[model samples]
Target: MLGQERSRSFTATAILFLLPAVAFYVVYMLLPIPMSFYYSLFKWDGISPTKVYSGLSNWDEMLHDTIFWGALRNNIVLVVLSILIQLPIGLILGVLLTSRIRFVKLFKTVYFIPMLLSSVAIGLLWKYIYDPTFGLLNSFLRLIGLQHLTTGWLGDPATALFSVIGTICWQYIPFYMILFMAAIVGIPDELYEAAKIDGASDLGCFRHVTLPLLRGTISMASILSLVGSLKYFDLIYVMTEGGPNHSTELMATYMYKKAFHSFEMGYGSAVAVAMFAISLIAAVAVMGVTQYDARAL
Candidate 1:
């Protein structure tokens, strides 16, 4: 009888601990997600006094909308580029900093500053850097007698999308850097010492010891980067706004355009749904990959 009373007390305490957080989530994030679903069935400007229900009509239009596809393709590009470029570079930098390299703190801080800055600030900063007219990049290229390498990075259609991608990658690299650095630092020094006693070269030690142990951390980083890229909007929207012929339109940007710019609230909701679906798919894929790799190890 006493034990049963104690169990009840424990359960009540746990409920008390969880209630505030659950309430906050439901009030803020969770409720809004379902609200989007309900709003998706109605055709009305957000300010309209009358909402006309058009079940599945908006989704049907979205299925054939070319712009949605472009945005989705751009998102896919960001996702691929993020994983391919950011992950390896951040991992390598993390490994170097965590090693017996000189002035590790200084280097880590320098790399992390970009991440600490606002995304808007980073976007504006990169815009000037990529400017063709009297910009630092062009000036440096001319100084080095590589003047032909200069191009209007954010303006040229051929390069605009890539330029935005680069900015996103640059701003985000430090986050992955810090994540990898933490994982690498948590590894015991004895592992490296044992590898050295076995006469393992630096590369061999990294491959054998560092990579395997860092698997969990890498998986986590990959998931974050993938999800962030899937829903990416701020940098691209600020820098290009899908300009130079919509070369950089991402799914989130497209949703914004439909919702506010075009005043098609229902269709915008549909786009939002699609964006949600795409993000969910990408997240699931990364999870699957991480699980498979973890099991193989």
Candidate 2:
């Protein structure tokens, strides 16, 4: 009886400690989801006195919206490019930084500068770099007699999305590099020593030992890249506002434009709900695949 009473007391204390965080999560995270869905079923301007019930019309409209499809395609491209470009480059930098190279500290500081800047600042800086008239990129092209190659980088539909994507990758690569660096640091030196003693070359040791050990970190990074790409906004919005014929449109940017800019709150809510669903599905799929691969190994 005494032990049962003590256990109850401990459980009560634990609940007391967790109450604030649980309350915050429910209020900020869980509540917003259902509210978004509710708003999605109405045609309200977000400031009006009355909300007209639109039922499933918003969802139906989304299904037929070509722009939404384009934005989703862009999001997918971002996800693929982010994983393909960021992970390998970050891994290389991580390996380089962790190795006994000269001026390692300086190199690290230089590489991490992009991650330190705000998205808006980086966007503005790169916008000038891509400017058609007297921009750094065009000036360099002319200096090298490659004037034909110089054009409005962010203004061209063919290049706008790719240009923005490149900037995004540059800004984020350092973050993944740091993540990889930490994971590499946690690896036991004994494993590499044993591989070396077994006549393994640096490349061979990395392929056999390092790659296998860093699988979990790689999987986690891939998931992070995936989700982040899906919900990406700010920088792209600042750079292009999904312009040049909406070539750089992303789901988040489109949603913001619909809700706040265009004042189509209901449609924006629908887009938001779609984004949430897609992100949740993608994250679940990635986690499931990673778990399956782990179990298979």
Candidate 3:
């Protein structure tokens, strides 16, 4: 009975220690979610003293909104590109940096510079670079007798989405690279030495040893990239404003338009709820797929 009392006392102390954090989460994160769901069922202009109960009408409208679907498709495209392009390139850069290359520190710093800059700053800088007439890209093309190749990159609907995607990749690849570099650093040199003694080439060592060890980090980076892509807003918003004909529109931008610009608070809340739902679903899906990959490895 004395030991049981002590155990109960320890549990009480632990709960006391956790109380503040739990309270903060309840107030900030947990409360807002259900509130958002509640708001989604009403038609309110956000400033009106009254809210009209709209039931499932907002959600039903969203189902038929073609623009919303387009934005969703764009978000999916971003997720795919992030997985296929950014992750592989990041892994390659991490491997190269960890190798015995000269000027390793310099290379690392240069590679990481993009990740350090503010997203808004990077977006503005690239906007100038993609300028059609006087932009750096067009100017360079004209200088090299490739004037015909120079076009309005951000203005053209065909190129606007991809142009924004490229910028996103440039800004985020370094983040994954850093994650990979840290993981690579944790690996033991003794393993590589053993592989070498066994007459394994560098490629063989990487394929058989390094890849397996980095599986956990790879899974983490993939999930981060997936979720980040889904909620991607700032850079694309600043760069394109979903521009040139909704070509670069993303789900987040669409939500902003509905809530703030259009003053459809209820509809916007519905969009927010959907956005949250999609993000959660995608995250769970990625976790499951990566878990499977981990098991297979």
Candidate 4:
């Protein structure tokens, strides 16, 4: 009886200690979520008290909204591109740098410089680099006598989407590269030694040993990349603001445009909710698969 009373007393004390954090999460995260849902049911310009609760009208519009569809498609493209290009490329760089190379630490710092900067700065810097009129890319193309390749990257509809993807890749690849390097360092040297003793080639040893051991880390990095891409806004906003016929519009940017620019607060809230739902689902799916794989092992 005494032990039970003490345990209950300790539990109450722990709850008291956790109260501030719990309150913070509720106020900052949880409350806004439901409030956003409520806002999604109304029709308001965000400044007036004349909100009309139109039931599912806002959600209905979002369902058939072409811009919303475009935003969703762009987000999907970003996720696919980040995983397909950024992660593999970063892993390759990590593998090479972890080898018997010179100035690996220097190279790492240089590579990660862009990622360390503000997204706005990175986007603006890349925009200038990709500028057609006086940009380095155009200058290089002209110098190589490939003047025909010079075109306004963000201005043209054809290349705008891809240009944004490239910018994101440049800023993100170094992050994954560092992650992969850490994971590679954590691997046991005995595995590689045993593989070499068994007459395994370098490529074969990497395929059998390095990759298998780095599985957990790669999965974690991939999941993070995917989630980040899904909620992406700042860089795209800084560079293009979904310009050139809204080619680079992502869900997050789209939601912001709808709420503030278009003054469709309710509809924008619906978009935000949809975004939250999509990210939540993707995170859960990735985490669930990773957990299952671990349990199987």
lDDT, model 3:
0.92
Segments in model 3 whose C-alpha atoms lie over 4 Å from true places: 1-20
- Write candidate 1's Cα lDDT for 116-176 as tens digits: 7887888888889888996888889999999889999888988999988888889988888
lDDT, residue 44, model 1? 84
Candidate 4: clashing pairs of residues: none
For candidate 1, the TM-score is 0.90
Q: Please give the lDDT score at residue 297 for candidate 1.
A: 78
**Residue pairs with backbone overlap in model 2:** none
Candidate scoring better on TM-score of 3 and 4: 4
Per-model TM-score versus the true fold: 0.90, 0.92, 0.90, 0.93
Candidate 1 ranges beyond 4 A from true positions: 1-20
Better of 2 and 3 by TM-score: 2
lDDT of 4 at 220: 88
Better-scoring candidate (TM-score), 1 or 4: 4
By summed lDDT, the worst window of 10 consecutive residues in model 2 runs over 1-10
Tens digits of lDDT, candidate 3, 29-119 = 9998999899999999999899999899999999999999999999999999888989999999999999999999999999999988998
Model 1 vs truth, CA RMSD:
2.4
lDDT of 4 by residue, 1-297 (tens): 569889999999999999999999999999999999999999999999799989999999999988889989989999998999998999998898899889988888798887789999989998899888889889999999999989999889889989999999999999999899989988889999999999999999889999988888888888999899999999999999998788888899989999999899999999999999999999999899999987776
Candidate 3 weakest ten by summed lDDT? 288-297
Candidate 1 Cα deviation (angstroms), residue 13: 7.9
- At residue 51, give the lDDT of candidate 4: 95
Q: After best superposition, candidate 2 residue 60: deviation in angstroms?
A: 0.7
